[model samples]
Every structure is written in structure tokens, then in C-alpha cells.
Target chain A: MGQVLAPGVTAPDFTLHVTPDQTLSLSDLRGRPAILAFYPADWSPVCGDQMAVYNQVLPEFREHDAEVVGISVDSAWCHQAFAETRHLHFPLLADFEPKGAIARQYGAYRDGEGVCERALFVVDRDGIIFWSYRSPIAVNPGADGILDALDRLEKQENSDGRAQSAGNGG
Target chain B: MAELKVPVTAADHARGGANGQVVLVEYGDYECPYCRLAHVQVMQLGRHFGDDLTYVFRHFPLTEIHPFAEPAAEAAEFAGAQGRFWDMHDAIYAHQEQLSLLFLMGAARALGLSERTLEVALEAHTYAPKVAQDFRGGIRSGVNGTPTFFINGHRHDGPFDYQHLADAIQSVRSGL
Candidate 1:
């Protein structure tokens, strides 16, 4: 297992291919919360189930103004096939050129495994990581943690805004 | 570390005693081979524990991989409408190798369900929302894969072999 990026640190920004002709940049989605799910590979048993679960709960994620993206060492072509087969609505970013480069920036890359560990990072609207978790290689590490973190972030933002307005009045 | 967020309720399709000492909940997909294997073990556990265990089954179909899963879950739910959910569930798993729409219709016929009603239900997806509800409930309960089990509301991270599960249940009973 790999160490997760600590909360409160600015998330490393990267642009990765989503399809043969499309790409997604981490920084571009900064105004809204983002969830980065790093997995070992495409088509594997555990990875397929994990991603499918996320696909099912997309509405819950969107309720908190969060966009979910999956990253792996697979190529764009591979991702396209997998996404089509699974009917996955989220973009699957390919870290294929350097193989696990984006995963490494998030501390999710494994040195000798040639793949990324099953990791999750929740970045707040400000691009700072609000929570992170590294699950056991075979476990799916369900979405509860991500939802809890997003809920906390929403509460934090509301409180911060209230304090700011109160200070101004004073 | 995942715990069952939603406890088994009156709305759930369950077997065994309602006030049993141990409640075993399985989030399963009808089309997954591993879930088939776990199905046998679950049956064994039920027989071994008898009245002491209350077993609940929930839908967690990996519809992308197991193409027949979602429809199969709906078939079971449709049967639930007739108060024969367990019969449909057992038939589906028992005939796991033949999970086609035709086979599902035949299973419903064998279980004394109206074939026309089942066909209409399947075509119109009458029970799809119910299955979707179960899937969402499974996600909320931290289910990431098929055949995931929760013994007394705590996620069972161990293997689903008979002895492992039986021992876990025993330990939980002793703790209580």
C-alpha cells in the first residue's frame, strides 16, 4: 500500500487523456469539489466492481457539487473500451504515457508493482485535499468516506461564509 | 471498516426467525459466479444455525460485467410482489448457469407465478425501481463487491467459506 496525500495540501495538478480526443485537467475542476479515484488497472475484478459502485452513486456525489474521476495506468483506448462496456458516466483519465505519473504525484503509485494502489483523494473547491484514504489492494473501499468528507467540506464552507459576513458586520 | 448503514427492516425480504440471535446480511449479484459459491455457503449457514439466524439478501449487481444481474434482480423483486421472493431467489441461484430472460420466465412459471405478468413486468421494468433502491441501499451500507456479507451489522472482511463465517458468527454470539 502507498501513503495518501495529506489533507490541507494543495493537490498536484495534471491533465490526462479521457478519450482519444478529449482530456481533463485537475486544476480546471477546482471551483467545485473533486474526487480522484486511483486504481491498479482496468478490467480487473476488484477495480471493475469499485468503479461500478461509484457509477451507481454519482447523484450523491453531484449533490455536494463534486465531480468524480478515475485514474489508472491504462491507455485511453483501454479506458474507452472499459467505460463503454460498463456504461460508466464519469471520465476515466489515463496516466499511461509515463505510466502512473499522476498517481505518484498523489502518493498512490507503487514502486515495484508497476500499478497504482487503490486510493481516494477528496479535494475541496479551493484545490486543497480535504481527505484521503488508501484501501487494501483487494478491497473496494466504498464511498462512505468520500461522502462524509464532502459533507464536512460543505459544512465547513457554510460556517466560514457565515463567519466572514459576521466579521464584516462587526 | 465498513459497517451496515441500513439495518434490515420490515420492508426487506428475509428468511428465518425475525428475532434471531444473529442477523446475516448478504449484498449479492445473481449473475456473479462468486456469489453462486457464497450462496451455497449461506444456505449451509442457515441450516446450521436454523432458528438462531435471520438471513437477508440485498441486490448489488455488477450490471456492467454481469449483464443478466439487473434483470435477474428485478425478476426476484417482481416475485416479491407475489410474496414469493425467496422462491425466485433460490431458483435463480440454483439455475445460475442459465440466467437468460427466457429462463427467468420459466422459473416464474415453475413457481406458480403468472407468466404473462412476469413478462409484462420484465418488459415494462415494473420492479426496476425496487432493485435500484436495493442497490443504493447496498452502496450506503458500504458494499463494494458482490457476495459482501455483514454479520450483525459489522462488515465481514474475511473469506466467505463456511467455517470462517460460522466461526465468526460463533464469536459474535459468544461476545453477546
Candidate 2:
């Protein structure tokens, strides 16, 4: 089994069908850092609340020049329903048919049950995973965590330095 | 934006099995100790209720912290392919710490899957997509955490041990 992709590893590029549109791809966000928040399911209490937190912090994400993308094993139709219900501003990709392929590739899919774990990966413009975190199924990670990582990434970018010593993860 | 009742695919029907009056859907994370504890309770419920109950397992593995969870899930899928899903499920919970690659292969071996075959199946990721599909289904149903159970499509509002599940099952079955 492929291990979880770690910091500085090249993120596997993908083009999943997302709600509000299906033409989006990770590459589309080139020249900017991106936040890939992979949650287990939609409409669940903690996941729903987490999305709302991300939505509330949209301004911070924009300020950091990082496009936020949420992913799940849900179908496009399901993604649409979830995005609408939560009023999410970002694209929620549906990895429906194959289930957790994207999540598995990113090393986030749990094997015992067929679902993506609550995982986060922050990738730089070149698709390098700069920071990563995975909250337990019982814990809902907040936007503050992502924002903190973004802040560190920005510092590294501003300094034009390697993330190794800069501490990309919070 | 409305949640649609998509028709069940052949795979879904096959995996969901024959349902009784009470269908229990559990959204769980393999790495979670709590979920593992819940796993025992779920099995107990299944045993106690027998023909009147059905259990559906869904994944919600937390990737960051638990490094071995995703692979453990893959192992379960490997067993599922050979028609030993429940056996594999119990094995995983019983040996959560031993779910690393080496240990998973050992578990498969104990379950009678040949080592070579287990290696090939796990490497091929034969059941990876199916695992993800379960996660998507849970998400569609609005599940965010592990061990979140529902009875007969109605969310069960408790810790979900034998008594709670038994009562819920009886309520649903009696009504039916």
C-alpha cells in the first residue's frame, strides 16, 4: 500500500467533477498555493460545521492567495446538495464512482470503512505538499489550523526559502 | 442542490445485503480506538438481533494522525473481495495495532488468503474505490464522525450499545 504523501512530496494532479461546475482541476490553481481539505462525508455535524468555518474564513484564504478546495467521495449531485446546504464558496469535488481514489492517493482514505478521513494538505504552486494534518474522526479541524499553515507558507514564500527549516506545518 | 435518492447500483445491492426491519448504518474510522470499541458493540447488536438486523459499515479514517488506518481499510477490502468481509472486519478491530502492512498480510494469511494473492490484491488496490464509495455514501447522509449509527434510516441518538441498538431495532421492527 502506498504510504501517505508527506511534506515536500509532489501532490498527484487530479481533475474531479465538482459541484457548481465539473471543469475544475488542481492544475487550474497553478501559480498559487492551494488548500485541499478532504473530509469523510457531507452533511455530518462536524464536517458541516468545519465547512462553515472555512466559508467564514474565506477572506483569510483569499488574502493568502490560496484557493481552497474541498474533496469527498460524494457524487457530483451530492456535492451540489452539500455545497448548497452549507453555502460553501469553494469547489467540492465528487470522487464518486471509485470512492476514495483521490483520498487514497493522498494517503487519507481509511481502509476499514470506505470513506476519506478528515485530512488536510497544503500544496504550493508547484504542487508540493508543504504542510499536512489529519484530525481524528471525532475531532473537527478548524480554519485556524489551515490559516496558520498558510501563514507559515507565506513566510517561506516571502523569504524564498526552503520549507524544511521554515516550519511549514503548524 | 437537493439530495436525490440515486438508484442502488448492483455493487451497492450486493454489499448492502438482505435488509431486515432495522438497518444499522455505521460511519467509522479504522484508526479510532473509540470506533474500534463501537465495532464490538455493533457486532454484539448483530448477534443479539440476528435476522431482524443488518449493519452497513462506512469509512471515515483520519489520515494525518493514524498512518496505518488507510492500509488497514485496504486489507479489509481484500478480504471483502473473497466474501469474508465480516471476518476481515472483526480481525481488523481485534488487531488494530497489528494492522500495519506486515501484520495485515499476516491476518490475511490467518484468514486463509495466500500471501502472494494478498500482496497482489492489496497492491492492485482492488477494493480501494469501493471503500471510498462507502465514505461518499456516508457523506451524502451527512455523517462527519466515526461510529455514527443510524437505524432504519433514522439517526440513533445515543452511544449505540446492545441495549440502545436493541431498543431501536425493536421499535423499528415492531412498527413494521
Name the top DockQ candidate.
1
The DockQ of each candidate is 0.52, 0.04
Over 4 Å off in model 1, which ranges? A158-170
RMSD of 1: 3.5
lDDT of each: 0.89, 0.73
User: A-chain TM-score in candidate 1?
Assistant: 0.93
Candidate 2 chain A, poorest ten consecutive residues by summed lDDT: A161-170
Compute the lDDT of residue B39 as modeled in candidate 2. 80
CAPRI-style docking class of model 1 based on DockQ: medium
Predicted structure with the largest TM-score when compared to the true one: 1
Q: Alpha carbon lDDT of residue B97, candidate 1?
A: 98
| lDDT at residue A41 of model 1 (Cα atoms) | 95
lDDT of 2 by residue, A1-170 (tens): 33567898989988889854554788888788999999888988668766765664566688888899888888888889888765678888886767788898899988887888888889997889999888766666655467668888888776775444355534
